[model samples]
Target: MLKVECKKWNQSLEILREEALQAEHPRTRERLMALYEICGGTNATLVGKKTGRNPQTIRSGYIDTMNRV
Candidate 1:
């Protein structure tokens, strides 16, 4: 079970890396990087405050936007 979870996590990381690579808009890329930095393993609230967005909103929107691409 842990191995499966690890695999999925790795795959998600790969997707994020690809998205970052393909990002063209400076703002979008910045937002994505911020989201990545916060969501990578740290506290979400800290990121939200730093970005001037609600944590839940930023998390949901970031995931939604990334999944769309």
Candidate 2:
């Protein structure tokens, strides 16, 4: 069970990373990271405008992506 879960988690992380790379805007991923940093590494909407996403979207996306790891 643990092995299965780990495989799933790894796959998810790969998908998320690919999505980030294919993002329409280059700064979208960067903004996500910035927000992560601004929120004390917890993730927050510090640069919403730059990211082209609202606080909620950014938070959810970041959480989803991080969870894959």
Candidate 3:
């Protein structure tokens, strides 16, 4: 049920997708891809399934990073 707080995003979905693709680090790409998916209306659970990650990682870890920015 976790959702992305899109208002806080400084970058657009296209930018996020591009950066995710270009990201060299595996962890960084995963986080960016999670954000990109969430911003595009895919929920955390679904994104987690797609990425083979725990939903909480997307909901709390990735999304929470945005809060600190």
**Best of the candidates, TM-score:** 3
Candidate 2 Cα errors over 4 Å, as ranges? 1-32, 35-43, 49-52
Preferred candidate (TM-score higher): 1 or 2: 1
lDDT, candidate 2, 1-69, per-residue tens: 001122444444445455556678866766434433443433355445555668665555555554455
Considering lDDT, which of the candidate structures 1 and 2 is the better prediction for this target? 1
After superposing candidate 1 on the true structure, give the runs of residues whose Cα lies further than 4 Å from its correct spot.
1-22, 64-69
Clashes of 1: 0
Task: For each candidate in the order shown, give its overall lDDT on alpha carbons.
Answer: 0.57, 0.48, 0.84
Query: Per-residue lDDT tens digits of candidate 3, residues 1-69?
Result: 665665676678888899999999999998988898898989988988999999888888888777666
In lDDT terms, how accurate is model 3?
0.84
The best candidate by lDDT is: 3
Give the clashing residue pairs of candidate 1, or none: none
Task: Identify the superior model by lDDT, candidate 1 or candidate 3.
Answer: 3
**Per-prediction RMSD in angstroms?**
5.7, 8.1, 1.6
